[model samples]
Target chain A: MTPLIEANRVSRTLADPEPFTLVCDASLSVAPGEMVAIVGPSGCGKSSLLYLLGLLDRPTSGSISIDGRVTEDLGEAERTHIRLERIGYVFQFHFLLPELTALANVALPMRRLARLTGDQIAERAAALLEKVGLGDGAGKRPERMSGGERQRVAIARALANDPAILLSDEPTGNLDSANTRMVIAEFQRLAHEEGRGVVCVTHDATVAAAADRRIHMLDGRIVAGD
Target chain B: MKGLMVLLDVAAAHLLMRVRQTVVAVAGVGVGVGFFLAVSGMMIGSQNDFIKTLIDSAPHIVASDEQRSAARQPALDAFPQAAVTVRGVRPQDEVRGLKDWPALLADARAIPGAVAAPTLVGAVAVRFAGRTEAVSLNGIDPRIEGKLAKIEESLIGGRLIDLEARPDGIIVTRPMADRLGAHVGDTLVVSSSAGTLQRMRIVALVDPDARAGFYAGDIAGYGLLRTAQVLFARPNVVNQIHVRLPNPQTAERDAARLEARWGYKWVSWEERSRDILNLLVVRDVIMYAVISAILVVASFGIYTAVSNSVADKRRDIAILRAMGFTERDVQVIFLAEGLAVGLIGVLVGFGLGTLLLEALSHAPLTMGGKPLVLPLDRGLRQYAVAGGASLVAALIAAWLPARKAASVDPVEILRGAA
Candidate 1:
């Protein structure tokens, strides 16, 4: 099967007073229907690579492609469009806008895509919340919900536009072990049963163990298990 | 369209979350607009009332003979473009009357909707019962001047048509009559600068108080055209022709046409009172300038409020950016906040301004130690202008902070947190 995301020898460098590298010469791919985990020590550039693969950051050298389309030369707006329509992200902090409720948070991406009517958006957002096992918390704001519930809502928000690939940077980093297990199970279900690729950067060994494949990185390079 | 809806929703949510800051911004704009409405309304309303007084008591159009400097020396016409300057040029002492004024008057009367009257105006002294008083002597065709100046409406003792009926008849103001201790039918001798004297009967008297507070109350007397022609030593001539119009608003256009056709100095009421009109313009400029300054200061309040909001919402901005919102979307959200604040302020300001004006109108007002009636303008158009100006000021102030929000780098922010 064709890979849903492909990164070929990508290297990202920072241009501060003294130049430094974030992700150096990393090559990887994740096919549809697979859950992959990127595990690393502190400052090993695992999150940086996740950002590069999600098209949130640009590489200083080499290219990354999503669903067979190369993205290095795309303009900012075109990149944003690609991210909106094809790739979804869930950060470690759950990052749901505190002002909006769970359902509204999930509806935000669909609203930006503008292909769905108000009723359709609401219906789909409710369905996504229920699928994430947070149906009862749909109307609750992020501040009122627990950290695990907020993370679940964030996951539902990531899937709002039915993106082909879900890129998560430490999706369970702030959650307790039970909530971390719940998130891992959801990621697994998304890849194995729902036919979407899932790539998560994580430090938790158990979270990494649940993935179908694990890519370990050190000093900005993938060292093993790519 | 849905995007805009969502943007407004988010903007409203942000503002609602920081309710205190939003209220402060709105109230600031409201105060500025409210003051603008009340102060400008009073000034403009009073000005309109004063202009109405001037228009009502003065001639709509005044046409006078153009004075010439010795017919331009005849030889100077040959060198029309000569660069040589003439110094202390003096005009020949010609009789002070329009030549062939009867034909000019006829032409003036021929114009549609024009009520024309010829007047030979001359400074004169009156002698009655061994007392003398200086006054303006107006030589008028009483029948036409009656309609042109509304003199018939202000008569106190006798009718104005008596000037036409009695050849040597005169109409004096009540003050002039009292100063002379003269009664109607009392004979008075009128003498002009030309050293001519004539005895005229006081056929009528007009009440000066009929049009109180108007400068037309100056001590004056009027007589038949023939009597004034003889007294002023200028026969069959008039120095001025006054015109009345069906619609006073057309006076300027009519004066332009008449001056161009007749080579006379045609002055409309507006031109005759240009100084007063200029004063009104200056007053309006100062009023609006000060009011706009208040709005600018209020806009600074909005600027600080929005800037603080942007600073506080950096996290939400980063997340929204990651969620595929373009920079422009972030900018629009903040801009919407500013506009919403300004709109709410304008609405509240309009209400407060109207209430204030209503309160002012009910309060006792005095001017020059006399009870005065306030002419307060409660027009919607002025409020609309004030509201629009406030909105523009607020938008300008909102622009800088919104730009800062849009230029935020999401990766840098998220990386710092990570």
Candidate 2:
């Protein structure tokens, strides 16, 4: 299968007291429906690699290609547009806006990414919630919901644009073992049944073992999966 | 859809949320508009009253032949060739440095501009009874005084006596009438500073100050030009010549040209009322200074309210920015809020100011139980001008804070805690 995402010798450096290279040289490629896991110890540039893959941060060198489009030379607006139209991200913490109800939060990305009418947004929001098993909790605000429910809403929001690849940075980091097992099972179903690639970073052996492939990072280089 | 929802939520928060700020801003504008309304109303009322009174009593102009000396006196430089040497008044003083009466009078009358030309003269008496009081006695031609001073309606009991044919009768003002203790057919004794006891019958009492005429016992006056001339002991002197112009507005302009040709200086009523206008101007200036401070302070209230809104909504503004709302959108929202405040405040002020004026109009300002009336029209205009100014001012006051709110950085909102 043709790779949906490809990174060629990407590195990120920051200038603090001295110039420090966060990621020296990293290269990776993944195809559609291929669930990959990248696991590393803390301070090993795990989050930096995710930011680079998500297009939230730019690499100091090398280029990223998504759906065959080279992105390193693109302007700020073009990059942001591409990120908005194609990418979905689930962070360690559910960064759902507290002001809106669970349904409103799920509806936000669809509303922002498209100019759908109010009824259309409502229908889509309801369908997305029902898929995430939160049909009854859609009306509850994020503060009133449990950590698992809010994370479920965040997952619904991330799947908003039906992107081919879902990038998650420790999705079950704040959930209990039961919620983690539920979220892990959902990711597995999304990859195998829904035909979408899921790349998750997790320290849980069982969580990482659930992925179709496990890529281990010692410092900044992937050592397990080529 | 998300942006709009966010915006609506923000706007609602502003509507129901910032209670203190909105009220203060609205009240500020309201007070400013109110003051403007009240002051403007009074000014318009007072000016209208003063102008109307002047229009009713005073002739539009006075175009008399200027003489070199006293009444009926020949010009200082007279025509030696004329028989009997009884030369009428001339209007210019330029010829031989002495103004002639008959020539100037004829020149002014021939201007095609002068509609009514009546000669007028008045005298002051220092002592009338055992007590001394200042009094003015006007000498006027009844045939033409009708157009000059409009004294016919001002007369109390008897008719105004004609000066062309002096009939030993005179008219006095109401206050003069009351002070003199004289009435119609009563003999008024007037002892001049010259020690001349000129006892004349009070034929008429003219009260231009009040619509109703009043009487005085010792005051005396007369109209017969010959009698006035004999009483004052001046052969050809008339103190002033009054004229009625076809148009009162162009009267001053015409009077200017008339003075140039006739060469005797004359003053327009407005010019003559310089002392009064100066007093009015000073009062108006002081009033504006005092009231404008009130308006400016109210605008300060607007300033505080808008800034306070800005401070409270900084995080909201940041959220809007993150949602892709441009800086201009943020600015426009705040400005719209300010405009709302201004509209409400101005409306409230306009209503209140008008109410106060209406109240003042009907409610007599009694001093010692005597009513002091205020004219209605002038008061209304004054209020309108003052109120309008304040509304405009309030909007101006709100502008800066709105701009500041628009420029707030979204990154700061994320980094900074409320």
Report the lDDT tens digits of candidate 1 across residue range A83-190: 888888999988888889999999999998899999999999999999989989999999999999999999999999999899998888899989998999999999
Give one digit per residue, the lDDT tens place, for model 1 in B189-242. 888998998888998887755543233665677888878889988888889998
Q: Which stretches of candidate 2 lie over 4 Å from their true place?
A: A1-226, B1-13, B51-57, B64-115, B124-135, B141-155, B158-166, B175-181, B189-199, B208-239, B243-251, B376-384
The candidate that achieves the highest lDDT relative to the unseen native structure: 1
lDDT of each: 0.87, 0.68
Show the colliding residue pairs in model 1.
Answer: none
lDDT (Cα) of model 2: 0.68
- Model 2 scores a TM of 0.64
Chain B TM-scores, listed for every candidate in order, come to 0.82, 0.74
Query: In candidate 2, what are the lDDT values of residues A147-194, reduced to their tens digit?
Result: 999899888878766777788878888999988988898888888888
lDDT of 1 at B371: 70
Per-model TM values vs. the true structure: 0.89, 0.64
Each candidate's fnat:
0.59, 0.04
Question: lDDT by residue for model 2 over B1-418, one digit each (tens)?
Answer: 2345544444434644677777877777787777666666677577766765665556666644453344344543475555555455565543221245666567556656664443535455633345445665556567766656556766767676432333767666666766756566666665443346676766766654444222222343445665565566655666566666665666678678767666565556666556887888888788778888887888787778767878877765654443334566677667666666777787888887878778878885865556877775544445556656666666677789988987796544532431
